[model samples]
Target: MGVKKTVFKTFKFILKNRLLFFLILLILLGALSYYYSENYYLHEEDPSSENFLLNYPDGHVVSLEGWVVDVYPGGFKLYIYHHGKDTIFDVRSNTNVSVGDNVFVKGNLDDEKIITAKKVVLKQYWMYIFLLARSALAILIVIILLLRYWKFHLENWEIVRRK
Candidate 1:
């Protein structure tokens, strides 16, 4: 059979078993929500709070304490102190922080090999769009799965009468 026909056949089978399909879907979505919520809650941690520091290992923890220096077109840079040493860290261009605002950043030190920010506390607007898109996709998948189940039941009844 062609690829399209094979896919249709599989979909038909899934639709015919609506209860099973829905149950599996519920489990999948629940797991996804749980995972995403964990990551989302982590974003709420306060960098300036002493309570936050207790969670991270000493050497791995980096604390940047300074006022926002320059808000360039690309990104904002902060001048901070590290054990009497001064250093500059750049927040990506799209961050919502303004110049001259005091802030603290708590993050791990990525070795100088290739710098990558695992988690950035500063406001980034595009994250909302990404989250919305994910929600839309999950909704669409559930709707399609339900429609397939209905189609399978209708087709199955038709086949029985023909026989």
Candidate 2:
């Protein structure tokens, strides 16, 4: 048999086994969703600041606990100990904190020693909708492919038996 025909025959055989095909499809979809969700959560962006730290290349999320250094009208600057490096964060002045108060700030670490605050909490909510949409589309495509394979196998089987 030619290579094309041999490949098609093998594909037919695999599709005829419905349980095996579905099981493989499920595993693949699950793996894709896991990967997407992990990456989505790991790279969330904070939208509170005009200068989003996550927008910077190689920027990372960090938590800094330190005393407020200077409070300005627009924003306040915080001197924080971040990963053994002293860093400054331009925080919104409206934030409920005093200059001498020790506070914990959670945001992205920028190259210019700035942290753009997304939220005070450790968890971020920006990427949740994106991750959900991606995962749903992936699952839908897998299901459609599985259904198409089943239909193709049924049609081919009927033709072979008619001979």
**Can you write out model 2's per-residue Cα lDDT over 1-163, one digit (the tens) per residue?**
6999999988898798877888989999999999986676345443222223333433666554566777777556776663355556676535655556665666666545566665542212234456678899999999887665644346544322221
Report the lDDT of model 2 for residue 61.
61
lDDT of 1 by residue, 1-163 (tens): 6999999988898888878789989999999999985675356443332322333333354444555777777556766654455556664435557766655455544442111234446533355457788999999999887665544436444322212
Could you tell me the TM-score of candidate 2?
A: 0.33
Q: For model 2, where is the 10-residue window of minimal lDDT?
A: 46-55
Clash pairs, candidate 1, are 15-149, 74-93, 75-93
lDDT of 2: 0.60
Task: State which candidate has the highest lDDT.
Answer: 2
